[model samples]
Target: MPETSRPAHPLSADEALRFTASRATETTFFFDFDGVLSPVTDDPDASQPVPSVLGVLEELASRVARVAIVSARPVSFLRSRFGSLEHVDLYGLYGLEVWHDGDVVTEPAALPWVPAMAELAERAKAELPQGVYVEYKRLSVALHYRTVPHLGGEVERWGHEQAERVGLRIQGGRMVVELKPPVDQDKGMVISDAVLGAGCAWYFGDDMSDIKAFDALRAREAVDPAFFGVAVAVANPETGAEVSSAADLTLDSPEDVARFLADALPVLAR
Candidate 1:
């Protein structure tokens, strides 16, 4: 369920954007890359952000206190896609890594788990089904069954077994399961810390992992009603309904998100 009951009549996307823009200089915007900025793809490497959204984010970074990408992808991967925006920050591996000022900062606690993750990745490649895509991040591993949907259950089972054997944490997503260091860090923790001193914060996401981010926003509102937080979910065929139901508003696609942000520029300017 949503942290707050749905309003009798919810604010439209444009209305929500304008409301957040009202506190432009004191606001922060956090976005999830896959399925939000970029369409979720079978080949994760092929995913790319909507062209117009990059320029929009650059503009937003100048107006807002912070503009960031909080994603499951590693900082290196995110940098490959969005490294050019100097003002945009990247929090990858669900906050286990960050790209700031041309340098990659990884959570020190997770560094020791690199060897474990590497071994798990190789094991996954050798044991998982032929169609399963194994993505190996230094701090985590993802098993993607998007190409063979029917194998989702098997892949998930395998991932959990591996996690238990290695004492790693499991994060489930759209036809994918991931194993990461058991560190006490996630999107929720990242957002909770980032929103400090900001009058308004907006989080855009498209999966179950992002619910934690929305919950962080709600937790803030609970403590301080004056703090305005918006949870926007980008619609997708899978997990869209569940994620959107938890969000304050929903946009149909990444293109819609681009246009939504672009439209808010003038409002923030005023």
Candidate 2:
């Protein structure tokens, strides 16, 4: 099969409806939190889902076999962000943690890597350029330069170096650099595990970390001819070129993603 290029824009409501209808029998939906459901902000702590997102997700979850959030944030952070919503399943730490049914299940071994990551973040703050900022997320460390665009390249290189030295992986996102343990648990792995052999799945995201999930879903579809799904990218200016190219569809922003989800649920549920 020939590889198709990624679309520059999201599917229209009609297109989404047709796509969903085609996979009505076995469809699951996975989402990313920041920039997919919530707007991206200078302060990550200030980011929150649009008022309607939770309601839309709740409705969509009732219709689909599963609704999971695969995010780069820690499971605890994700819980604090959207734990009140009963319908959504949370996959945090870039898939290292899973929260469901009011219970948090984690890969205990990954816990030990937290302090090491923090130390790396501290070193980045001290060594990187003046504009570079580090976010120590216990299980992950993010070097951010959104506030200082000129330092983006410097921060990115510093993050890569730190990851190499620590034997961790570098996950680049919008205006940020993340370091995490070298694990096979990526967004795609998390979605694949959550679906449990489901024939169809749709994943929406807005950053580089989401590319793994897109690749995983596409690979699964290739392996099983009956599998069908779409990888939707919410296009923010901050998103990397590689991430945009890897997506099947690209929406304008978090608002657009919410609109797409809201419109798709009713038809998909039928």
What is candidate 2's lDDT per residue for 1-270, written digit by digit as tens?
212332223445465456566555566889999888899888887788888888888888778777888888888888887877798889888778888898888777788897898788778777887766677777788887888988887777777877788889888778887888877678877866766677668889888878888888878766766666678888877664667788777788888888878877767766
Best by lDDT: 1
TM-score for candidate 2, please give it: 0.88
Tens-place lDDT digits, model 1, residues 123-157: 99999989999999889999999999999989989
In the predicted model 2, the residue pairs found to clash are none
- lDDT value, candidate 2, whole model: 0.78
- Estimate candidate 1's alpha-carbon lDDT, on a 0 to 1 scale: 0.89
Worst 10 residues of 2 by lDDT: 1-10
Clashes of each: 0, 0
Point out where model 2 deviates above 4 Å: 1-16, 22-25, 129-131
Instruction: Say which candidate scores most in TM-score.
Output: 1
Off by over 4 Å in 1: 1-10
